[model samples]
Structure formats: C-alpha cells, structure tokens
Target: MNHRMIDRNREEGHARLYRDYFSDAPTYTETHFRRRFRMRRSLFLRIEEAVTTHDNYFTQRTDVVGVRGLSSLQKVTAALRMLSYGTAGDAVDDYVRIGESTTIESLKRFVKAIVEVYGDEYLRRTNDEDVSRLLRENEQRGFPEMLGSIDCMHWKWKNCQTGWQDRSHLFEDLAESHGPKVRYTVNGYEYNMGYYLADGIYPSRTTFVKTISKPQGKKRKYFAYAQESVRKDVEEHLEFYNLDLQ
Candidate 1:
C-alpha cells in the first residue's frame, strides 16, 4: 500500500530530495537505484487496469480515458497526493484538466464512500469488551468510564499558500522521506469516557485530570514529576511505532 510509481513529475522533486542520499546524484536509473533506497511500488495497479475494471468505482461513471485524455496511473497518483497536501487539490489541478475545487470535492466524496463501505468509525466508546481491554492496559480501576489515553498529536500540514504558511508546523519527517506536519487533539484517557490526565499547561475539565494547583509543598512536586515521567513514556512509545511505519 505504500508503493509509488516514480513518474516524471515526482522524479524531479524526489531527485532533489534524495540528492544528498545518493552518491552520484541527479542522473540515474530509478528502477535500478530505488533498490538502494528501497522505494517499492505503493500503488498496486497499473494504469491499464483502472481503465478496464471497477464496476464498484466511487465516481459517477465517466469515460476517464476519453474525457480527461490522461492515463489511469497519472490520475491516481495525483488523487493520492491530495491527502498529503495542505493546499488540498492543487497538484491535481496541475496534473489533470480540472478545476481545483472540483478535484477537492471529488476526493472528499471518494474518501467518504470508501469509509462507508468499511464502517462509521470514530473515537466514541463502544461495547464493554473494548472498555475492559483499555483499563487493563492502563492499570486503571476496572470498569473506568472513559476509553483510552488523553493526549494531543500533531498531523503535519504541507506547503500552504503564502498567507497561511505561518499557521502550519512540521513534525519529525518520516524515514520514508515523507514530510511531517501535525494536528493536535485530545484522546480518550484511561477509559472510553474517563477523565483526562493533564499538566498545568493543558486546560482542565470536570471529566479530565489536570494539575493546575498552586505548588504548596514538596509532595505536589513529587506527584507532578511522576505524571510528567509517565506522559513522556507514552509519547516515546508512540514515536517508536511511528518509526516502525517507516
């Protein structure tokens, strides 16, 4: 699923990216050199198969070949990049003959259609079996109300229009050479619906745990350090798995 075709458009960009990575640099055979870098085909199908099959296609039935006058591979690559782009469908507009807004709308509809075929998924607490598993992992009291850990994660946003550039922040880039950006959020802590464990910096709610008290003495300091250390351990674990994806 992580494979990608090294088409002409992406070649120039990737070449510049990997310039330092390769010894000889600019001019080289991608098919031969990718083994050195271990770039595999993320996209499973060839351009021909897309044109021929897919009765279950998400879009309104159209003659993709005749109307767009483009190959299936080119179109699929452009579409996938939109998910990573902060500018949404901008690359699609450049790669295909279409309005940017139309491309964005189509991709949104495609994602929804795929997920619907899969399931209506979200962070809400489900049945008790899932609840029990989470509590045992956290060493919390059995039958806690909440789901899992309470934490914020950053999802990287790619290149934005000049005006919006300042709003985005890149996180640790991937080992696959994918750029990193982040969107932070709160997750269920302890249980599917239990209170959050937070520091003075994080906001407090009646449903969550927060440490915002004025420091009265040494006991408070000790407890704060304990929570802080545990939180760091969790983040380190997350970061470890993130590298595994690479």
Candidate 2:
C-alpha cells in the first residue's frame, strides 16, 4: 500500500479504537499540567534536555549532523513506521525511498536514544485511594475496585534471551522451559488468574456489587472482620461473589 494512504488509515483506526475503548470527557479546567498524562506532549524534548545538561556529546553530534540534525527525526520516522504499521526494514525503504542501511541505522539509533534517555520512569506504579474515595473520584459503570479486564492473545515475540524472563524463578524458569521457540501467554493458566477471581474466561468487562449486603462467607468475610486495606489492595480485586462474571 502507498505510505501516505496507509498512515492516513492508521491514524483513523487509532482514533476509532480510542473512541471505542475509552470515553473522551469534556476538558476540565480544574486539571493541571502536572495532573495530566504527558503523553499528549513532546517527550523527546525532555530526553534532549537531560542529554544537554549532562553533556552527552552524541546528542550534539547527531542533532546537527548533515542538514541541521535530522538524526532524531529520522529515527522517529523509522520507529513510527514499525510501531504504527508493523512494517519491516525493507518495507520502510519501499515507503520512504530510503536505503536499507540508513533504515536499519535509524531503528538502532531510535532504540538507543529511547533506552538511554527514558526508562521505567514512564510507567505508572500504583494508586493508593480508599474504595469510597475511588468511587467518588472516578466512578465507572459499577465496578469500584474493578479496574480492567483481560482478553487472550497470541504473539510471536522476537529474541530467545529476553523471552526467558517469565516472572518465575527467572533462572529456573529459563531452564525448565527450553525448546522449540514457542510463545506462551505472559500469565498462562486458569488458577494463574492474577486477580482474586477464579480463572475462567467469561471474558468480561466488570460489574460491581448488586446489593449492599454484608460480607457473608469466604468471599464476603470482610463484614465481621476488618481486613487491612493494604491486604485488600494486595489481593485480587475480583474474589468475592458467586457471580462468575461473563
């Protein structure tokens, strides 16, 4: 497909997916810059600031080399090609009319710049809020403690060495499962349900408690006993109830 046409279509598809999976609420004036997710703005600028501050000379070399520092921009273009459309190196050349070596270098530079600059500082660790406050702050359909659901997917990831880290005894897990380059689910298994809920694929969204009844049994044992909020947070959110959510 023509690169222009493909990019246009990809942008449209992303907008559609965002609309479907998430709601776009009216902009709240109360929101501050720090309060908002920085994704909507330029993160590369932040990385550049860090480099210049620490006298990372590579930034200066690549940024101003050959026609006013097209290096960063080139890598960004290359990375976006793969990230947006899953296009390989040759495919990127076909689209951008760039040489294969240039394309490969673009990818390498992009990866190096990204890793060396921004790391896990970009990930959201956790949020600590009581159930009542959580409900009042950001009430969803009904599920309060309920955050998100899961759907099964299969992926053919590249690289065996990196794939070895499976969250178990890293070394032992590596040794235990070694063979025909097979891709397994990240958290595979029924009882492997990370949440407190039983492992079954009612493959659902979420539904909060229907009644305000007291915690009655094992699932509802919270009534008679005041469990530590920390423990509750630590445990899976979907444990209580006979309702096998579908």
In TM-score terms, which candidate is top?
1
lDDT of 1 by residue, 1-246 (tens): 996533344333333434523335534565543332223232223221332244134233336553322333333434445643334566555434434555565556544443343233321224456445544555553223333333433222232213223422211211122221212234542222343344444333443455536656797876566556655554434222222334
Best-matching candidate per lDDT: 1
- lDDT of candidate model 2 versus the reference: 0.34
Clashes of each: 23, 2
Local lDDT at 245 for model 2? 24
Lowest lDDT block of 10, candidate 1: 168-177
lDDT of 2 by residue, 19-138 (tens): 432235423321332123211113333543444444333242423434333233333454545543456676644433444555676656555555455433321222333223433322
